[model samples]
Target: MRHRLVTRGAVALCILVAVALIGYGLAQAMTTSHQQTVQGTSENSPHSGDGTKANPRRTRLEVGLDGCTKGWDDPGAGAQVFDIKNTSDRPMDVVLLGTGDKAADPHHDPRKAQIYAELEALGPGVTRSMTTSIEAGHFHFSCMPEDGPVVDGTDTNVPQPSAELASSLPSPVQHAAPATEQELIPYTQQYEEWVKGQLPDIASQADQLKDVIQRRGPNWREEAQSIWLTAHHRYMTLGGAYGAFGDLGDSIDGTAAGLPQGPNDPDFTGFHRIERGLWANESPDDLLPLAQGLSNDLSSLQDQDLAVGALEIGLRTHEVSEDIATQTLSGVDDFGSHSGVDSARAQTEATQKLVEILRPLLADRMPADHLTAIDQRLDAAQKRLDDASAAHPQTAPADLPVPERNAVRSQIGQLSEQLAEVAAVTDIRRAT
Candidate 1:
């Protein structure tokens, strides 16, 4: 009897081990498969602008189906089927991602923000529809499980689905009380109007700044020197300080949202040209203060934007303010470059003022995570500053020349990028 019992126990243990191994293998397989999909393609799915008003898409967002063609219609609610077919010679899978309550960042937009369904392994011209559903929040549709050009049985560096979409999450909000079309329509329209107002303003500003730098007349040198750096700086800060979350801090499903769409649209190759001109293609040093100022200004502008919409923007104005303050102190300690500290401090002060002016817009909307991240960046910046301070001192605060200037401006540019990424991660207002 003892011998028989031992044999049974051994068998049970073996089964459990086998099961565990299988589960682990599946999880890894899924992860590897997803990565293959992300890095595999650089093409944008074509969007059809031809959907009829008579059958307008009631869905919050429609993916995979074209607005131009009649075959695909918008989804109303619940799980939607997009009949995505890869008529192309290759085989591919469609991976679906959801955005619960997270607002889409205009920059670094969510993967789902793309117009067409995610296509994987399609040969030339083959067509198929992908099926998906809408949550009251944001979502993404991408091609997944791709068996791409492989080497050594390994698909080199294909990116998997981003962290936000890898899981199938339960909807946190009650769908029965979904935000009505009436409420969202007004905000959407308002956003469009606000966006249109800036084109001329941006062009005019860029032109004026460039002329100042070229003339090297009056204060033009200083202004011209800083123009490109400043604009990029401001753009970065505008990007950083906030992001959209799915559940606005309530649900773990919250992921960063859309890329910037209005003046900040990355697709606007024009901005890049404009950006390059601000520096005149020279190195970007004297531009630090200017760029930092821009970050401060842009952050302020976004705060103002939320106020216009009654969007209940979160009150994170001071988070960036505090970050700037903390870094100035550390920079003073480490670099002995009072110049960097002085400049950084001045820009931060502007950021602080912007926060104060826009505190009311935040109301109850901002999430805790957003606030926390800004502080983290500030803390990291301080470390950099402190390290600079403790190093062997340079003879004199060097007047920033082109090459040196470019280096500083590049740092400012990077700083701006961080700010924007944070802002993108935290701008989570929904259709409420």
Candidate 2:
């Protein structure tokens, strides 16, 4: 009896061990499955690792001839994802706008609306995702087809959150409200007047350049170079009006970058072409016609009505700084004269003037602190350029010490970014 009891006891111990092993295998399998699931989710989610196990609510928005946001239903105020699909035959643009304090109307004018997010050039049958946080407001999507007019989606009214919930919710991104074309007209006119005023001085300098080239004296080359640089700098200060200048602009200051025969192309007849001939030791007589042509172009520019549009004014606020950073600093515009540093200084001055022209409008639309930051960045860039010029006068931009060159580039880059904000704030929006 005692032996039987001991054998049963040993069997019971074996059963317990077997059950323990089985439990361990099940736990391991579950852990592996859970890890695989998480990995798959991370691969598919755009906003993964946002410290949340559940994905943000997603709503599908269909863009068709009928409407821009046909499939959207109010998802209540919270973080959400939009699956924007273009159901039209052509490409389209979609903008989510917050019409502040206004009645929820699908036909509300977008010029007064604050843009929350936008998806541009969404092609037919293609779908894209936009993630954003929504707060209590009157919201709608404006869909613009490449071939048709803009169609607004049905308005979605998100109820205001409780004070406690509002405090915890992430603030939604809101771009500065757009300006109207009428509001921008006065600023454009002012800039056009300023551009016109500079033309006479530029024309006079061009004539001086021609005279210096004609003299062929020992110091003629030096005088011609000085006059050419002065004229070019003055023209560059009219950066805001370059678009309005159109082909005339290319004729005056365009480089030989894209020409078929480069410097020999017939179209390569501008300040750069003259620069190459002067620095290459070509005969003054050979360069006489180019100088004459430049003077004529300036005279013609003076006679024409300088009409700088509102859009160009907004774009130039940033484009001037961009040109300095990309072209001047990179030595792409240096044909032979290596006067990039001087050109950059002229462009910087132009940008400063543009900012001042938009200051009144910007102050009304953007935060004062943001405007101050933009000014500070511009000042920093100007200071860096001044220090470089004072320390190494007439040195080429690329030839400056690496640290100094980098400092200038960095400051200009920052200034460009800030100025881009200005462009966006001042841009005129259209409702059709």
Q: Which has the greatest TM-score? A: 2
Q: Model 1, stretches more than 4 Å misplaced?
A: 1-338, 355-366, 379-418, 421-432
Error of 1 at 104 (Å): 25
Alpha-carbon runs more than 4 Å astray in model 2: 1-55, 70-74, 104-110, 216-218, 265-267, 426-428
Q: Residues 25-116, candidate 1, lDDT per residue (tens digit)?
A: 00111111122222222222233321222221222222221111112222223333343433223344443334333343444323223121
lDDT of 2 at 425: 61
For candidate 1, what is the lDDT? 0.32
Clashing pairs in 2: none
